[model samples]
Target: MPTPSRIEHDAFGPVEIPSDRYWGAQTQRALGLFEIGEERFPAALIRAFGLQKYAAARANAQCGVLAPELASAIEKAAIELREGRWDDHFPLTIWQTGSGTQTNMNANEVIANRANQLLGQPLGTKTPVHPNDHVNRSQSSNDSFPTVMHVAAAIEVNGRLRPALDQLRSALAERSQAFADVLKVARTHLMDAVPMTMGQTFGTFAHQVSNALARMDDALPRLLVLPQGGTAAGTGLNAPAGFDGFFCATLSEVTGLPFVPSPHKFEGMAAHDALVELSGALNTIATSLLKIAIDIRFLASGPRCGLGELRIPDDGLTSSIMPGKRNPTIAEVLVQACFQVIGNHQTITIANASGNFELNVAKPVLVYNLLQSLRVLADSASVFARRCVRGIDVDREQLTTNVERSLLAVTALNPILGYDRVAQITATALRDRVTPRAAAIALGFLDGDEYDRLVQHPVNCLINYPTVNRAAGA
Candidate 1:
């Protein structure tokens, strides 16, 4: 076995616990147990947690509940955690027994131990910075965990997903304008229906993204409804009278986020409707991604036997047995990501609603689901957009050929030839492998003048590709 690297420091004095005691068990067990994997706590989440602790200290200082020196000490310890400086000290298991009591206690113990060092005292001492008294004086896991969730979600979305959306929109805009002259057959229920420019298809995608962004903007404010003022049971029992308002104002200033004081602290703490609402916005984004992924998959279906409207980049080996088979793996991954995001939304809803009147007992699950959903969405959206959507190349030849071969182009002739005559024109053209006008004239549907007038007077009348191209070119 390896020598014990147990942390000897305490919050107040020298370490008094033995090797067998659980007082220092966190450091020993956490380092030993989670050794199987190399994953550490997320740097972004740690930063946000540190900012929360810092903001909490400042907020408490306004009421003078947390003294200046102690508040400063908390800030120092949180800074260490944020910088990952105390990797050895943060040995508490990520999956703790008390529903994130370990993470919360990890911060408390770590901060308290460090603050005692600042005061020339042993670790675990509460004289300078009592982890619960001064550090978490006016806060609860009920409030802090969700607060960090919002902070991280907002940061990720603003930093990553929004930029990706803009990239996709811009790429589609350029593709739309580029494909304006290329005609393609639009299908309804996988059957040829109408003629449309491929550019028009891209324009529709752009509009859908624009609407998703609007929904995102509208849903984010609900997350700002926080439960910070509700200390234990939404009574402000130990907090000062005006601390809630001033705390929110100062916290907002420090974090550069708009933090609104909860008007209904009980509801905020007991119910995670805010989180559910935010997750629903993520579900919306996922739905959009799924639609876009579906479009990409359909457009790039096959090289010889499919629509093949666009070419997707082959990133890597798709199959072991098939030598030259490239797959839409990126779109598959993103679509699966969307599926999980929706599942995470449902988890949030069920977890939040399962709580009691004043506090949600499933805080760990709440943070886990919310963080997972936001992280996956923010990263996956950006990745799929830039790597897949933006890189797609249209096959103009394939698209135009498909459109030209489609018999639905004669639908515009219904006004001149009536529905029965138009159907006859399409059927005869398909059967004889000739132009619809030639087939129609052969069947005595019209004479030369009538055929010319019927096909040319109305732009929708049956016309061969060459004639249409010549007219368009002229």
Candidate 2:
């Protein structure tokens, strides 16, 4: 038997919507027309719509455009939507209309129907509250969609992504302090270069994360500026004079973020450059994280064979074929996550560029990719900081061995014995497979006492004193 559904009318005639659904004809029509992808808009975006609708109703009421009782009903319903009570009501895919008009209509219909239900009327009444006229009063899909986009993106970046990054940076800084006294051989172009504390290396990773945080701060202001007053075509056609200010004030009060009206509503509705800028910041973060993860994996490469200067935390995961093999699983996971964020950034860039004269048709896909990148990066960063960076252990013995065996330690002798002499000493050490100190002594360039004083001393060679003393057999 066919499930019971009621008829709802729109400009395109009647649509048979399910009686149990809070959505009306427009949302029902959208469900049939846009079936392109299974990727529905995320709950964050839906909640943002709820917040936008609630703010719009209150703003319209303040402007004397909507009745207080109607606004009260819409506000109650919109709050329920924002609090995720009606998430199922918004089932449109991200592949819908470029302006997100369908999803915007979906919000309007659900709120309007639910509002009527609260006003002692059944669903699909469109009586006390109409989706277009009352629920979406003083707003257009073009402006409203982008306004919520900014709201959702700003909230996620500040609340989720920033804290995760801070956690990772804190973990790295703690490790840097712990490793401050340990000397290790630095690498350039995958070859041993010179002596440096392991702390300095981890400090570099922390600085990269700090820079990413700075970029996020720089991009946040643009996200806070909204263009909600621009009713269709970037003109405040049917909206009241102070509706934009009222909406922004109400939105900021609810969201706890300082949202402001866009000075030029045309740019906000026409282009998603702010979101693209945030995506670029996310891309930089991905790039930084990828570098740090790859470096950690490389340093923790092998227990007995490769340059195992760092030890990865064992999570009981091992290779199936190779016995007793441990993997840098967390670092590898972070690396892959960063790769996805990078790819998402490219998608956002292309989508932003696809905008036309008055409005961008790629809003849904653009915001979808941006939010995915934010969520993945935030989750991956938190996991990496907890499971990997905090638990990482340095192999002091291996670091010492590699440092003592490196021919580049001769770099320290350059100022004392000119570059030519140091180069000759390095060549001899490589050829004879002897330590640089032994090569210098055998080349008659320096006696044992002199070589010890010139190259073995921590101050002269820039090595940590206690660690280098043991490595040099002092």
Candidate 3:
């Protein structure tokens, strides 16, 4: 049997909305018009909408445009929405209107209907509270959606991604300290080079993460500047005089972030350059994470064959064809996640570029990709730090063997003996399958005592080497 429904009126006539839904005419119309994708807006964006709507009602009341009682009712309903009480009421996907007008209207309708219900009125009454006249007062989808986008992005980056990155950096720094004494041969272009401590290698990874975190912080101030007051065509049409200031003040008070009104309402509504800037930072972070994960997996390639310089944690995940074989599953997962983040950044870049004239029509897709990148990178960073970096073990035996067998150790003798002579000695050692010490001694280049003093002790080559803590600015 058909579900019980109620008729809701709008500018386009009547829309039959389900009786159980809190949404009204506009949202119901959008439900039928936009059947594009299964990817709905995330909870973060919805909660942001609730917060935005709540702040708008309060701002309107303060501006003497909306009645205090009506503002209180809208505030109560909007608070429920912000707390995720009516998530199902927002059923629009990210593939909807480019301006996100449909989703903004969705928030208005849900808040209005629920506010009426709060005032002892039946659903679809549109009586005590009207969605457009009150809930969305002094706001347009063009400005409101972008404002919510900035709020949601800033919250996720600060609350989730920054903490995750800090955790990962701390784990890497701990490992660097733990492996400070394990000396290994550094590789250049997959070939052996001079010797360095494993601590130095891990310290570099920590530094990269630190830089990524710094980049995120750098992008936040711009994100905090909102464009909410730029109603419709950036003219503040039909909005009160100080609506922008009121909105930002209330929003900042509720969110605990320093949100400020955009000085240029026209630029704020017309362009999304600030969000694009944040996406660029996320792109750099993805590149850093990908490099770190790939390096860890390469160093922990095999227990018997490949580099074998590091041992990955055994998480009970075994290859199907090979029993007793444990893979670097955590690092592999991180690498894949980084790849997805990189791709999402590209999508955001293109979407941001698609904006033209007074409003960016690609707001929904742009924010969707940006939030996805943030969530994925944050989750992967946490998992990698906890499961992989913390439990990684250094193969001291392999590192020692590789260091001793490396022909590039001749680099230490370049000052004592000329480069050409050292190269000749290394060539002879490799060709004869003998040690460089033997080859040098037979070639009359150095005595046993001199060779042992110069080449045998790799630390002799690291003249005035800085500690890992100093190198990493710890």
Candidate 4:
């Protein structure tokens, strides 16, 4: 038999909804219309919607607008929604109405139904708990959806993404300290440049993550400003006098975060500049992560042929038909994730730019891309920290061989011998395919005793005669 359905009426006539679903008419209409993508809103954003509704209901009640009993019912129902109950009912795609009207009404209908059911009323009964007049009493999808967007993005950055980055930074710091003395040849423009401790290499990456974290921290204050009270067109049409203050205070109390109403509700609703700024910060972080991951991949390139300066943990899966080959899969995965984040940032930027006079028609897509970027970056950081960064080990033998063979070692003779003589010695070393020490001896630039005294000094070409003499002698 065909599935049973129920007739639900809205302003635009009636919609045939599935019998068992919690969503009502507007949601059913949206489901039938917007078949744009399979991607739905992130659970965090949905939960944010619930929290927004719950706070509004309490605020309306406090302002003597909504009945306390109905407000209590809506609050209870919204709490269930925020806790992830009835997630399946929110089936609209992320490509729905730009104001996210469909999803907003989806929440309203679900909350109203559940609230009525709590009061011993039958399903679809709008009595005692109407979806519009009471549930979404003083809010519009225009303000409400962006409010949830700001709230959700702030929480995700502070709660999930930052913590993951901190973990990655700590892992790198540990490796930096652990490899403090492992000398390695540094590369500039893919050529051997000079010598640096592996600790310094890892420390540079740690500092990149630290700077990214700081940028994100700097963007939080803007993200905390929400566009909640400006219903419809930033005019606060039906909302009471102190509704915005009460809503923000209630939201702060419930979420334990400092969520304040935007001073310019028009800016908050019309332009998503804050989200654009946040996405830019995330893009910067993604760039740093990609650079770090690529560097790690290069350092762990090969066991025999490539750089082979570092050894990465094998994740058990091997190269096809090559039983002994272990790829730098974690770093590759992280790089790919960062690439997605970068691309998503661009999409958010364009969406932010597409806003018209009074309202942006790109809210849904903007939110979807932002949350996806955050999720991917957070997960990538966690995986990279555990699988690659924490377990990386320096190849001591390879490091030593590369350092000894580098032409940059000729840097030591620059102070003792004139720059012209050091240049001649370096050219001779490269031309003869011999070590700098051998070239120096063969060209009589320095004797074996002097070459050893200067070239193999422990401080690596600081050129302090007394310190060099003591280190060379010791």
Each candidate structure's count of clashing pairs: 10, 1, 0, 0
**Candidate 1 — which pairs collide?**
10-123, 10-124, 11-123, 11-124, 11-125, 12-122, 12-123, 12-124, 12-125, 13-122
lDDT of each: 0.69, 0.89, 0.89, 0.88
TM-score on alpha carbons, each prediction? 0.84, 0.95, 0.97, 0.95
Model 1: residues with Cα > 4 Å off, grouped in runs: 5-44, 83-99, 118-127, 316-318, 433-438, 444-474
Please provide, for model 1 over 1-474, each residue's C-alpha lDDT reduced to its tens digit, 9 standing for 90 to 100: 854433454344344333322234234344545444443445556566766777777778877887888888887777776677665544443454323455665566666667777778765345666767777778776667666666666666666667767666666666666655667788899888767766667766766676667777787787666677677777767777777677678667766768787887877777777777778888888898789788879988898888899888778766799888899888888889889999988878887777876777776666666777777776776777677777778888898677657777667678767999889988998998886667778888777677666554443322222322221222
User: What range of 10 consecutive residues in model 3 has the weakest lDDT sum?
Assistant: 459-468
Instruction: Please give the distance, in angstroms, between residue 336's alpha carbon in candidate 1 and its true position after superposition.
Output: 1.7
In candidate 1 the C-alpha lDDT for residue 455 amounts to 50
lDDT of 2 at 254: 92
Where is model 1 poorest over a 10-residue stretch in terms of lDDT? 464-473
TM-score of 1: 0.84
| Candidate 2 Cα errors over 4 Å, as ranges | 458-474
**Candidate with best TM-score:** 3
Per-residue CA lDDT of candidate 2, range 366-466, in tens? Answer: 99999999999999999999999999889999988887888887776788899999999999999999999899999999998987776667533443334
lDDT of 4 by residue, 1-474 (tens): 989887778889877878788789888888888888799998999899889999999999999999999999999999999999988889989888788999999999999989999999876777789999999999999999999999899889989999999999888877877777778887999988867778778877888888888899999899889888899999999989889999999999988889898888999999999999999999999999999999999999888889999999889888799877789999999999999999999899999988889899899999999999999999999999998899999899999888778888778778899788888888988998888888888888789998878767843432222321121122
